[model samples]
Target: MDVRKRKTILFLGMALFAMFFGAGNLLLPAYLGYQTKIDWTSTFTGFSLTAILAPVLAIFAVAVSGNYFTDLGARANLKFAYLLAFVNVLCIGPLIALPRSGASVFEVAIQPILPDAQPVWVCVLFFGAVMTASFSLNWITGILGKIFGPILLMFLAILIIPGLFIGATVDLPPTIIEDRFYVGFHEGYQTMDVLAGLIFAVLLISGANRKGYTHINDKIEVVVKAAIFSAVCMLLVYGGLFYLGAHVSADPTEITRSSLLVHIATQYSGVNGIYLISILMILACLTTAIALTAGAANFFERLTNGKLGYIEGVITVTLISTLLAIVGVDGIIEYAAALLNFIYPVTLVLILSVLLFGKTIQNQKPYFITLIVTMLISFIRVLVNWFPNEEVFSAILNVLPLARFNLEWVLPAILTFVITCFALGRNLNLKRNQPF
Candidate 1:
């Protein structure tokens, strides 16, 4: 590839990172401060690990693994790889996180910018137009590369700098009690970016592959470095947002909205701060929404083996997501995170299992068994939540260990994966004529 081509690839990779970092990204940390209260520091740190570090690492991991993220799942078997890839596409699609981008961006940033004379529908129309434009973006990757690309980086700089500066002006609200660490650790679960990371990092890898440096090591280096760059920026911005929120929320009593940071900025830094943050957030969300639509369309096309193609798939998916965003759901972020608590622990273990036994389990059977078992547990939980009245003991997950806290699936999933892997391994060895 030409030098410029490589640069473009890296640029697209960066854009992928930016797109994953959206309006939802801006709001989660600030709300963390408001809810965690004086214990905001620990909460922020715990959240950052999943919210920032996990996604960043996953981006590089896929780059090194290969073009298909499903390949990781396939390392153990084709079944797992297929399921993971499919789930990731859906998670990043309208089934969950993607629609939330437009809904959130519109609710948190765009609508706020309108004047008293302008009706709320005007904001809705504008947001709808964004969805249209994003669909059309299938034909103009460069336009996005040039415009929203720089806008994202510049705004991130602006958003992060003010946040870091807020640190000097205010100390974190002190931890309110013992076990702040545990609270902080669980708070990280709310971000669910790790769940998003397992999916979206594939987008980052695609951008890198477009530049044509297919060598795994080279891709690994670029992915790792870029993830690091992006992670550091994310960490600073999120931490600042949380600490700054602590500063602004010193009143001990303030209404907590989804857009708490904007509210806090307006309260502390006045009108300019509010406008600045809002614009940045809107732009960030716009870029992110575009990427999610584009990515889903692309993934759908791929899964169907080019059934929809670029233009058709983009239009159809984007339209659906836009419409979904318009209708909106209540407590969307919380719902999305809760959705993650079910799948993510299993996904996390699957991702880790590959890293652990990548070479040892070249056959798909072990991966397939582990992934299927995990999904079985997760899906069972999903069904239980769906029809609580159907299950006799559904109300008593607490008696069953991790189930009480809604995390029962994790330990069992892990246990099943290990047992199955060993059983599979032992069977494979026996079939190899080695009688132990």
Candidate 2:
């Protein structure tokens, strides 16, 4: 890649980073910080691992394997790819995330300042305008490059500047959780960064390709650097929010699945702060929502034998996504998560399989076997959860054997990866493919 190209990659890369750093990214860290009160450091550990590592690994998985929706599901059927793509869009795009982004931005920035008797649709009307503006933009990359490219660092600074100034003014308190590190780690998982990371990998790959690197290796190198830029920003923001979370304690109830940051930032920054944060939040969310639409479109285009081009595919997806969003954020999230949990174990297994044997699926049966084994573990999790009352079948539960949390899936995924590695060692003739 030339200097101009490298600079282009980095610019788009950073913009992509800003896109996904929306409501969850902003509020969760601050809420986690607030929950820890004085134990922000400990809680942040949880936040970083889940929010940071998961997303990074996910992007790396895509780069390492060179797989997106269809490629990721190549081992499976095309139907699975379509399903996976649809569910992923719901999770990140307009359905669950976009409206929530608009809502959270308004709650933090707009709602507090209006006269008590004033209508609330001012914020809703504002976000509706945002949707229109985002739709009118040309290729998403163009929109992001223009909006996020220049503004990302400045917006990040906005959130952090206030937090730092406020932190110095107040005295730090003692720890909240008994084990801050573990608490932080567990809390980190709640952000679902790992899941988002997997989804973002497609965007990273596509964005890298748009810069026109002919070689897969060069393209991957670009992907890695861009992802690093994204991951680093996420880490800093999460850490700040975690520290912010530790500082204030106005309403624990405010920090539900949504609206965590709005509650906290509102407590400290006053009405002016809210307005600034809302604008920043809208920009970040818009970038992410547009990118997600593009990704889903790219995935579908590939999966359907090029039946639809990117533009047409995006329209189809956006229409469906907007309809789903109308059902509301809570429902959409539940629907996406339920489907994702089923697909992800298989998806994770396939990613490792591609890494292990992109060159010789013929030689490595165990890599193929690993998918089944890991999926069985994930399946058990689903099955256990399927039944609300295990006590109804005590004998059956005792006979089948299960973890209380159904988290045994983690062990099997690890075991499959390790076992497949051993198998690959036995079959040294297995082919190794290059990064594209």
Candidate 3:
């Protein structure tokens, strides 16, 4: 690639990295490190599968299909496509992820320095800036990549490098969870990067096109290269945080995710490191907030057929998310977990089906059957969580493979797809050979 192209790719990669590396991204790995102890290697491998690999693949899935909604919605039909897009927007936008970002800034960054700070005002000021930056959607890649991305990386390095070295001197405790890999895999869901990938892919593809990558092959190549670069950056930072969390000499169970991060920072560099982490959290959260707001606004503007303008979408999302953020980070987190359980499995099925079957399975019969089955199975899983004591439901669901692993939908989805495809294929053959 030429120098200009190379520069565009690098900046796009950085912007993607910043968008993915939000509060949940930072907190989950650190807490996993604390829990995994000596089994950090296997645990992190499992964590990386869901947190990094699945998300990157989701981006590729969208790229291959050419349009995010059209490709994703191909199998299920137009109405399903719109509904899925709408839910994806809400889950990753104002309803859950966006509010969590602001709440995280307050709980992890602001609360440490100003213990008495009002969350409502914090969200107001924070999202006020987010709203302003989000209005310039064309500039998101440049703003995040050229400016905030670098600063976020620098602060993370400052916090991580010293913590890793300092932590090495302290002997750590035994692993808390016996099944480290499984625990890490399950915990990785909380990051929600895979779901975000479906929406964020649109932004990345648009950014690449604006940078003059017009050819389909060129866009695919650029997205792949940029995703690789972003993945490498994420691995390094997540690895460093995990190392810090694993090596902390203090009682890991006693501390919350944000508190543990702050504790480690303060331990390594006293008060200065605390301030550094605070800045890091704010920037990380702010950049992601901007990206989510922009993505949602763009999608809504299109969804409403221009009735809802981009600026209006931003304003509406900002106001809603700001109010939700005031509900506090923990509450947002609790609610998000429930919603993710419902949506994520269906999304996974959609992405994987597209990648595996391509356009061949776009016929409504097979597509809808597979997704409906997956959703039904996943709903049962969620119901089990809601009513743990309901023996009838729990016992019925337990027979499915990986039910204990929170992956009860996998087998059912695959089986449904295969059976539907076979039935559809035989019908087509019979019709073709029959005498008119």
Candidate 4:
């Protein structure tokens, strides 16, 4: 790549990093660090697997497939493609992630600085900025990469460098959870980066094209390179935050995730640290909010074949997300966890199937069977969360291999896919042998 092309790729990577490094990305790792404490290595490993690695792989999967929805939707049919795309967009957009970004700003930034400030006003102003920034999708990479991305990184560096060193000063307690790896893996889901990665891949690819990467190979190479860079940045931030959370002298159970992060900052750098962290949270959340808003609007505009224009889509998303954000971060998180439990497995299976099988399993049977089975199992898992008290539901779920780990759907999905593939192959063979 030429110097100009390399520079564009670098910034694009930074832009992608900013988009994925949002509220949950900031808060969850730190809390995991605090909870895991002395067992930080194992826990962080598991956390990075889903949180960092999965998202990176997702970006590559989208790049390799050429079309985001079409490639993944090949086996499932158009309706399934549209449906899954819609749900994924909604989950990462207005319904959950978007609002969580706003709520996080309130809890971490506004609440700390202006104790009596109304969150409604904060959300209004915050989203107003998001709307304005997102209005021109063409400029998103430049805006996020050239400006906010650096500010976000600088703030993180200030916090992480000192926080890590200072955190070591305060001796911390034992690991709160016995199964550190499991806890880390499960907690990683809360970041939702993998889901965001799928949506954001479109945006990233668009950025590459606008930067004059017209060839398919060129686009894939740029996206993959940028994704690798983004992953490295995330790993550093997450590891630093996890370390800070683990070594903090305060009791993890006693403090909220947001509070614990702020507390860690204050401990390391005094009141100045609070301000840095506050700005960090606002900018971090704002960057993600902008990316998601743009992604949702773009997807809807295409979904409607421009019947709903981009501006109209933005207005609709902003309104819904702003309204939902009023429920606050905790509320959004509570509901998101349940929804993700149901949808995430299907998404993972889809990504994996596409990556592993390529064009071989493009026939609808395998995709339909795999997705339907996964959804069925996942839906039951959601119900278990909804009705934790029902003994019968608990007993039935307990019989599954990884039910306790909330991964009860994995085996069923794999088995269904393999069987469907085998059956399809046999049918193809029979058809070939017949005189037709």
Candidate 5:
């Protein structure tokens, strides 16, 4: 690659990193470390699979498909594609993720520093700025990657480096959980980056195209390379946080995720550390909000086939997100959990199916069948939570392989795809050889 393209890749990678490394991204791994204790590394290993690896693969899935989320989803069917896009936009956009980021900013970055400040105004300014940035969709990557990303990284390094040293000196406690890997793997779902990946990859590809990497080969090459860089950056930061949280000397059982992070910060650097964390978190929240808003706006604009203008879409998303932010973060999180559990497994199936089998399996039958099986299984899994006492729901999943691991959909999705493909191919052969 030429120097200009390399620069573009670096910025794109940084932008992607910033976009992914939001409030939950900051909180989850450290809390996992705090909880998992000596098994932190094993837990992080599992966490990395879904949190880091799956997201990068999702990006590649979109890149190879030669477009964004819609193209990949279209493999199943247009209606399914639109429905998936709409739900994903709501989950990751105005309804859940966007508001959650705004709320986090107020909780972590604002309230601690300015206890008297109203969340409403804070969110207004935040999403107002997000709206402004979304106006220049072409420049989202540059603004975040070139500016906020570097500052976020610098502050994060300042916070994690010494904390890691302090944590290293403290002996780790015995793990609280037996199934550390499974816990980490399951906990990784809370990050929600894999879902975000389907959306953000559009921004990256659009950004790449605007930067003159227009050819499909060049676009994929740039995106894939940038994804690798972003993945490495995420791994390093997450690993550092996990190791630091694992060796924390204080009792972490009662503390919340944000509290544990702040406690660790003060443990290493006192009051100055609080300010550092505040800055780190604000930038993290802002970067993520910007990306989410832009992606949602772009998605809706496209989803409507330009009936909803990009500016109008941004305004709508920002208005909804800001209003929800005022209602507080906790409720948003609770709402998101139910919605995520319902959609996450199915979305993962779609991403992996596209990435692994999309090129070879050109037919829609396998995609449709696999997705239906995954969705039905995921729906039952969600129902099991909603009606835990209902034996019908529990009994259905209890016999499925990997149900104990909370992955009841995997075997069924795979078998459905293979069977559908085999059946379709057999029928095609029979028709071809028929006398008529």
Candidate 6:
């Protein structure tokens, strides 16, 4: 708590906020509010649980584990740990998030101004910028924390402060969804920051180390404090936007999510609103894209045991992300939704298990059993969505607890862990070999 330490924590917190507040963070809450209307409170609660609370917990879990994501994941076993790491990184990096950043900026910020602009060229230019800006972990955080983070916050403040005066002008519409909390919970999956948190933890730890917090306890303290700071900032911004959305007089069905945000911004501040939001989208998306590119490069070099150089990884990831960006935001979101549904429950289980049982649960069997059951149930749920008419799958899934909430995996994962622990008894107390 010296002056320098406080300054480091402040900047780290700002950088973490910038990294998490990406395309989904900007777009989802307002749309959820618009859809839920009078039910905005309950829906926002559910959204904040996954979107805000879960990601912060993911950061804490890694910090407590005294290592990066691999150590946390290796609680199950080395193979499963590595598999989840790669999938989580790819999902948040090139496949979905990285590309969606550019695509969203194009759709929301660019296309409206330049009707003739092609997304391909915009993406190429965007990724080219990302590639050039890719720096070491500490440098990346320093730049985002000191520069982009403040500018992004300033842009948000310009729009959101005016938004508070805006209220529902029409007869507020009735809620369309019966289970508003569940709908919010389901929508929260689309944010995907919880998944990003696992990897962002790596960057945070490295940043702390270079800042000279070399003691293990000191490292955990700085990371946890910074994460809490980020969580507060996210809740404020997301809550403001969600409240603003509830007040906007627009049809959710008539407008796309990104467009809905644009509409609200314009309503709040008029022509100047458009300018603020356009700039917001570019800075927000660019901050996230840059962070993801750096994070991905770090992961690849680690995965290949340094065979893949950091610069090479950055170039390769940018190239792939550039190609995928051409598909546009909605298309990427459609694909990401399905994939996230399948993976999120499993990831949540892993994070919660580590935080809850990681200290005493020495044997990997319990973690293994719990995660496998979670994955099986989650996969079945995804299949049920894909083939809605399959009576057998529907019948089996509906029987699970929380099915109405689209969280049917929760009960089974808990039951499986308990049953496995009881069945194994003292045998479950066996020491686990270190994965590393």
> What TM-score, over all chains together, does every model reach?
0.82, 0.78, 0.95, 0.95, 0.95, 0.97
Clashing pairs in 1: 76-364, 77-364, 398-404, 402-408, 403-408
lDDT, candidate 1, 170-248, per-residue tens: 6455555555445555555554566566555666665555656467776666556656766766776677777666666
List the global CA lDDT of all models.
0.62, 0.59, 0.84, 0.85, 0.86, 0.88
Candidate 5 deviant stretches above 4 angstroms: 426-436
For model 5, what is the error of residue 91's alpha carbon versus the real structure, in angstroms, after optimal superposition? 0.8
What order do candidates take by TM-score, descending? 6, 4, 5, 3, 1, 2
Number of the predicted model whose lDDT against the real structure is largest: 6
**lDDT of each residue in 233-266, candidate 6, tens digit only:** 9999998888888878875567998898889988
Worst 10 residues of 3 by lDDT: 427-436
1-436 in candidate 5: lDDT tens per residue?
A: 6899899899999999999998889888888998999888899999999999999998999898767787888777767877987898898898888888888888878887888999989999988888887888888899889999988988889988997767777877688697789888877888889989999999999889988889999999999999999999999999999987887767656687777777788888888877887888889988998899999999999878899999999999999999998867677777677788778888899989878877677777688778988988888888888898999999999989999888888899999988887888754222111111
Model 4 C-alpha lDDT per residue in residues 146-193, reported as the tens digit of each score: 898888988899889977666777776676587788778878888988
Residue 191 in candidate 5, Cα distance off native in Å: 1.4
Q: How many clashing residue pairs appear in each of the predictions shown? A: 5, 11, 0, 0, 0, 0
Better of 2 and 5 by lDDT: 5
What's the residue-level lDDT of 28 in candidate 4? 92
| Full ranking by lDDT | 6, 5, 4, 3, 1, 2
* lDDT: worst 10-residue window of model 4: 427-436
Best by TM-score: 6
Worst window of 10 by summed lDDT in candidate 6: 165-174
- Model 4 whole-model lDDT (C-alpha atoms): 0.85
